[model samples]
Target: MFIRKLWAYLLGYLILVIKGEHPERLINLAYTRGVHLWDLCWIDAGTLTAKVYASSFRTLRHIAKKAGCRLRIRRKRGLPFLLFRLRRRRMLLVGAVVFCLILYCLSSFIWTVEVSGTRRISQQKVKELAAEAGLRPGSIRFQVQRDEVVDHLLRELPEIAYAEVNVGPRSRIRISEKQLPEPGVGYCHIVAEKEGVIESVLTLAGQPLVREGDVVRKGQVLISGEISPAPPGQDEQQGEQLPPRQEPRFVQARGIVHARVWYRFYGEAALEEIQERLTGRKTLIFRIKVPGKEVIVYGPREVPYQFCRLRTHRYKLQRWRNISLPVEFVTIEAEEVRHQHVRRSYEEAVEMAAERARERADRGLPREAVTVRRRYKVLGGDEDPVRVVLTVETRESIGVIRKFRPENQTDKTGGKEGV
Candidate 1:
């Protein structure tokens, strides 16, 4: 059956009815001439129908006329006939080719950008920088280079430690940026932030004021910027006069001052609490959106649930490599929800409050600091607001840059120059 149909379509064929005297004679002539025919049937004494290739149809003409029979085409089919019809509408064919060309052209250009992993940097700023590097929306996808764009971002923004520009489908570009940490305060002295004994000292730059095992108080200068260098390899004769008087040089102090610090946090929570949440009842509506118009072809016309939260997700139709289409498919879901009351036992509330307090205390911890000790205390009963207090003892750098003027240093030798 497949072979017969294929043969008919390949050369184009016609279904014909023959009428005249001795139509049987025409059939015999077709067989003798090797004209392919199938499904030959005699409907009445004067009429008969059969299938023949379009090329064989003309071959039967002379045979039918000689046999005193007339052949009439009941239906025409196949590629040849279709092409013949299409040839008449020249403009339609041209329009179809033009439409395809336009689609391809539009798809080659970028349309939108998605930025991720940015905190201080704004979306517009990122886009502007990307635009300068030829990665902006509306730029040609094939023309825009991702590596070059990344290089441009790193060069333009000193804060950016890492950057990535990824081109994806639907004419969209995704940007990822990691910012470098800002430098510490410049030109300042490191001072003691709390009263504690100096366990050990590591001076990167500056003069050491307090030595190891020395007890220092709050606001005390742990590392001083003023220094008087001893004469190189020179023997000091106390009985002899000094060669000359040396002046102390003032500079910015820098170093880590490890001191014992205390962190305290307080937290309270009520035994009874109310929260609004979804009730698991929801309705989903599917739709198609084009420009400013939306048409729902499936699902409910209106939301089926009351006191519900509605979430709509829309996906625009797109083609090869980020070529977005104007049409979009949207799924809207309505979830029913209500206010819920939660009652916690005294033990439960205390644990919750304690965790919150602990988190708060830990929040203020400095990087690389060792937690030497930790303690927790509960102050209120479950009937009252459960209050939990957390305290932590840490050993970390309490030193921060405190800038000072060189002129403020007192003259140790009563000289006019300040140390």
Candidate 2:
């Protein structure tokens, strides 16, 4: 069917209306005379419609006349007729050709630049670096060197460990930042990070300063990094000769001090609250956006509802390989909404407040901490909203490295050194 239509279009075709007493006879006569006719239908008792190839229309007209029917051409279609029409409007033909050339020229240049996989390093910074390497917007997509852009990023930004550049309709620059280790201190002590009751201590390379069941405050040393040698033994003392005083050695402290820590979290919820909900009514607006301006193509310009939510979707006109048109189709959907006051019972409000408090407390808890106990309490008077205070106790390692330097001179009087 498509091939037959293409053949008809290449040779041109005409739609004719036949009006007479014996229009049916015309169809028979045309078929008997070897003239092709298609889409035959009766418009009325005296009128009929049919499509015939332009080359065979003259023969069909003769057949119609002999069958006592008058033929009238209704419409003309096909490429031949289109070319004839364009021949009369030469400027339209020229404009079409110019549009094609402009489209082809615009497709060669880049329109958008995108950066992904960046953290700590700003996307704008990466884009600027890429622009310096000649891979920015308006640059030729095929001519921009991806390797140069990658190299420029890696060199200009020391934090970037890896970079990849892809040039197409939109230029994309992907980068991975180098993970740097934290600076270290040579001589350090393990100190309590928070006030807690010590449960146990495990020393890896430090002097124990706190014992089990002892209460330690924040910043208090849990382990000492300075080590002083033991005094001479009883046998050496009896020999009447004592070894010289030994100097304290400074070392990096490493230990784990598990302690019980407490966290207090508070939350409240009102028995009455206002919430917004959708009303199920929506309006859709379609628009076309060009480089400099946007035009509404369909739907109303102003939203009908005063309180509403808006969602927008945008689509580019056309894209092929590294080429994309500047035109975009935008659809905006506005949904009507209404706010209503909702009332909850006292028990429900208390539960809600308690859940919020629990969540807040859990967020503050460390991943390695083991939960020991939890307690919840209600606070405030009846006039106040339901309030909840949550107290959580957990056992966790409280030791943290604290750097310090020991005094160069040791006191002969055997006085303890200050940390």
Clashes of 1: 5
lDDT: which candidate is best?
A: 2
Clashes of each: 5, 0
Error of 2 at 315 (Å): 11
> What does the lDDT come to for candidate 1?
0.76
Clashing pairs in 2: none
> What global local distance difference test value does model 2 have?
0.84
Local accuracy of candidate 2 as per-residue lDDT tens digits, 1-419: 99999999999999999899988888888889999899989889999889999888888877877999898999999999999999999999999999999988888899999999887889998888889999888988989988988888877886655788889867788887643222355567889889999997777776898899999999999888887676875455576756745777666777667899998999898989988899999999999999999899998988899999999999886788999889999999999999999898888888899999988877988866778999998898553589999999998778787767567634442233423
TM-score, structure 2 vs. true = 0.45
State, as a TM-score between 0 and 1, how close model 1 is to the true structure: 0.40
What lDDT does each candidate get?
0.76, 0.84
lDDT, model 2, position 299: 84
